[model samples]
Target: MSRKIERLINLTIALLATKRYLTKSEIFRSVEGYEGSAETKERMFERDKDDLRSLGIEIEVGSFDPLFNDEAGYRIKQEKYQLDLGAITSTEVSLLSLAAQAWQGASFDEAAQKALLKLNSMGVPSDSLSLPTAAHKIDDGGGDLPLITKAIAEQQLITFTYVDSQLDRHQRKVVPVGLSSRSGFWYLSGVDQDVQEIRTFRIDRIEGEITSTKGPKDFEPPQGFDPARVFDGSSSQSFAIIDVRKGKGTSLRALATSAQSLGEWDQLKLPIYNLNTLASLVLWHGIDVYVQEPLELRGLIVAQLETLVSNHG
Candidate 1:
């Protein structure tokens, strides 16, 4: 672990072990890793508190010296810091083990592993049962996901240039409310400042870096605004009819209106949110898929394949 992470761990352990809140000066003097001038130590402690809070550790700040007006002290309440799940069956433990294993090689693998280790240290027995390797894996949503997630968590206003399904580009100012994934795509749902409406933007379609328009906690998500209900993935008017091979096109099936089996293929009528996206999914199946209706979509797929062939040739 790096120095910062080690410091955070030490800081957490120190806070958790203390019976009463520890003052900032006490922490700076007693904490093993805190070594700097008074100002530097104060700044580092402030950032460390934020980082620990971001990781779901609840650090309570209160005055330890009630007799006099003493500076505020900080401590992580054991009740808030520890998991309180009453009981776990063997089946649940096995499921948790499998869930932990599923994060292997993904961006969150380290954090998942650490969580499992912590749980195991709490006396949960490990199951010997093995599960089949996962066929589908989570995408990291490029690098913007963390930024968007932070924006949502902090309720910050953000600005980004986004390209819509019709390939129209616009600079959007939004107060990010939530982040969700659908069919391997990550979306950021927010209140669009220009339109003054709730809208969802696919993270991948964001043209450039997402920048914060204001400080954290700048806006509030509307009451009972669930991103699941807001993001329907049907933003375009056009739809496509295609034939997919059996056991394929699972993601496409979710957006399809109707499906009928035709021997080796499953005929599907899917809404065309973006022709480019539809064409790309069709090409992903290669020879196993074919467009049945709308000559325009077929032409788009053929043109894409021709371009690929020309580029390779």
Candidate 2:
């Protein structure tokens, strides 16, 4: 791991040091880790480029020569790569230091350390900054995240079995555009091959291994593809009437359009976007919440709870 990190750092330095864009041939000849056969070097360089991009290093690719048509070259522009949020106040510096310190023991600790080192080099004092220990942790989405990210970066097609809100499983081929996290769940937004439309799938709902169907840079993401706009907000906003125990269902309360106190129970008229997601939320409160008006939603929750019980049993 240390050797890989060192190789990436060396590659970045070499790329940034070069004034002109360096081609694959030049990189293989000049970089430290490019040993063995031509095929081996090519594979190593490809993986290195992906790794560097994952680390937030922007590698620009273009032709070095205008007079002659040559293979495209790659270079990390020093200006684009450097963090230059010019002349921040002391309060902002202190806040940044705290933010950096919050990554301690997390997946981003090393990257945070390297960033702080760069900031310190720029005359910002971060070495002695103290901060409260992070009380929360972010899950890195297991093995699938890296593969999905690689596909996104390389503009490659991917295949995965995704379970929808209705619990129907379907095998899908997609060109992933972006990934986003909301309410602790990760979603992959992409162009679905069969439907020929933009679709978003919950990462956790992906049934099995995510497979790459094509090589890097095979296709380009559609121009101005906004993943957030893929879902139809109007279609998802269906109302549900439910009763919750007093002092419970705090999260659900935020979704309630109207709430009325009925002795020990609080009746809520809520707009449910995804029934499966809402069912999960309701189930989290155990027997404290009850769906009254919608028989279908109540049935869904009961079925889900039964499946959970059977699985646990």
Candidate 3:
């Protein structure tokens, strides 16, 4: 990390750790990388404020007194600064188990661990990813993971109630084919008997119990069916070059194959293990992270953001 990035992380940690707004004098005395003459420190502080805002981190500026004009103080509101992905759906242990089967020790292992550390520092529990490989074993509120895994292993037909992205609830019958995992979510891709087509279902979104409709080896997976490519047609892996705003997209920075300083934005060549997974990660950084290559990935990011705005409009 550069001195500036270290300063920014330290600054963020300090501001987020405090309950009260810290004044400029207090910040200079306490926060690292704020050295130099008073005038120099003032300039650095102003630039830091701009950089933080560019990362979509809101710094609250207020005064100590309402009646008398006092020196302004700064603090960040957790509700505003933190990405409220909303308790984020938990990772399914079964998905991790499935991933462990096909994980194959890829480029994301190191970056994944670093991202876990960053998340843990932000007060997110470390249990989800206590260790690199152990990270894949944690539960994601998918209590039916074991059942799903068992159904797959037995080659049995299973029935379960699932809620789709649109919140439509329906009972699904699937002839277990193969399993796929990405970004902590487990997906069961198989032949949906009712729809008479292959569909991928997120394990966590599955509601109620998964019942085995028949004995083991009840059905065979469709000929030449590829679970990873089912429904969404997601590639196994992709490489992307991203334009990350300075002092932002810290997670991406950690995962980049190469990062070059581009003044305002850092150009990062990153290996994308899963495009949807990478898309979600990039979206988390908001405008601070921009995809400069792989137009498909950029389109996905924009489409997801637009859907969020449209649905929540």
The candidate, 1 or 2, that scores higher on TM-score is 1
Candidate 1 Cα lDDT to native:
0.82
TM-score of each: 0.59, 0.55, 0.38
- lDDT scores in order: 0.82, 0.81, 0.76
Local accuracy of candidate 1 as per-residue lDDT tens digits, 51-144: 9988889999898778989899999999898977668766667677677777677667777789778777767676676666577666765767
lDDT tens digits, residue span 136-255, model 3: 444445456556677777777898899975689989889777777777777888788877677788887888888886743445566887876653324336689999999888878877
Model 2 has an lDDT value of 0.81
Sort the candidates on lDDT, descending order: 1, 2, 3
Pairs in steric clash, model 3: 90-140, 91-139, 91-140, 92-140
How high a TM-score does candidate 1 get?
0.59
RMSD of each: 7.4, 7.9, 27.3
How big is the positional error of residue 80 in model 2, measured in Å on the Cα after superposition? Answer: 4.9
